[model samples]
Target chain A: MLLSRMVPTGFNDLRREMDRLFQDWMPGDGNFFRPSVFPAVNVWESGDTLYAEAEIPGVTMEDIEVSVVGDELSIKGTRKPMPEGDYTFHRQERGTGEFCRFVTLPMPVNAEKVEAVLKDGVLSITLPKAEEAKPKKINVRTS
Target chain B: MTTATAVEKREGKVRPEPTRGGRIYSPNVDILENREELLLLADVPGARPEDINIQYENGELTIHARVDSRTEVGEAQFLACEYGVGDFHRSFQLGESIDNSKIHAKVKDGVLTVHLPKTEAVKPRKIAVKTA
Candidate 1:
């Protein structure tokens, strides 16, 4: 089965295409192609585990929350504003606010065995496939 | 009184140097200035501390971060790939002289903060007034 056909990333493709168009029109500046969604994510599957990764820089572990209910996963977090100080901003491209994103799994996963880790500003979640979701091989006996 | 100019997005420009191989991305950054120094914050997720290199020369500051591939080649089947994973490279031109010895930088939660202290002559100073 094709992975792309199984997992649906609603509006992500359209957003990517729009980003590309803007990039072509206005080159050099990186902020022009930023997607409207905060903390872009990538999902892939290997063997019996399904993995999801999101890039949320400058956010501490305590500020972010991850939950998995059934076949749906949610990532919610807030990027706090910079500390109060007397300074003038010449360029402010990074965003600061509350954001929540939900991703639907391609197949049922073992919620009990799910694990998530945040390292170097990247959050990686590992969801193991449920017993029923794993592919099973059938043995044939000659009659 | 604190005054802010129009937010200009033309802060950093991507260099034309060819990378080792693979995709190279320009990380987003914020530049702030004060009476004493200029602060730069950049987002470079998935890049280890050891892999980040910062160099200042010829009135230009360059930041290069090396990131390893998350998955093996042709190993995992991607379902929804939104962002590309690769090295981050960008450079900025400094208009004022910087105190190279006092420069400091640190990375936390994939964000890199660089402190570029302005030279003594460039820093704004308050003149004392006395009654004659």
Candidate 2:
């Protein structure tokens, strides 16, 4: 099923870029951020840690990988297509493709200490902060 | 003026139905309040909290859920499905009203929760007025 989309600000830049890159090639209409096909992910932050979650329902621990470089974070994985068998056609809307999305974190993350857990088709990652980046209290000066 | 004629008219006027099987449904969700933060709860059956995702890009919050065990096949002998494996998405609009500096989230079992505390200058507070 096609998700509804209303143009956002400066959408013309996107059209220009598409045309500049594909002017000589077949103008593909459906090549973009198709949310339905790939798993959904969420990211949040606390005092010192940055958290990221990804949905890969049918995959196992081996299917997911997470890594952080400086303030840039990358999450990539493969979602295998459904197997062929005795399944009469009704609807096939879910996406099956290799997906890689790069996201930036608000604070520098501890790439060495990043922890990832995969359960129930979801992958959760915790990126702890370097000690110096965490919040610190300053003592009041009475002078 | 006849039953056959009425049925024909109805069929001719009704629009052709679209396929209904290509959907993903996460269960009812709840976001609760806490002393220090707020909680976001979403029920995703056959899903692991580890496999769920929550992200804050600028002020936009996006939630995605994926389950690997349940899948939909094209043909079926006997099929009854309440939920099938596919991608699920939900998002929110955020402004300076939230503490972009201190937001947290966690998922346990199949429920996903996000804790967004009000900024220090903005959190709920009570004031007292002296008797005039």
Top TM-score prediction, candidate number? 1
The digit string of per-residue lDDT tens for model 2 on B67-129 reads 553322332221112123444455544444557668777655444556677567655577888
Model 2 chain A: ten consecutive residues of lowest lDDT:
A1-10
Q: What is the TM-score of chain A alone in each candidate?
A: 0.76, 0.69
Per-model TM against the reference = 0.84, 0.43
Interface RMSD of 2: 19.3
Alpha-carbon runs more than 4 Å astray in model 2: A1-37, A84-88, B1-132
Pairs that collide in candidate 1 are none
Best by DockQ: 1
Taking candidate 1, what TM-score does its chain B reach relative to the real chain B?
Answer: 0.86
In Å, residue A90's CA in model 2 sits off its true spot by 2.0
- At residue B79, give the lDDT of candidate 2: 17
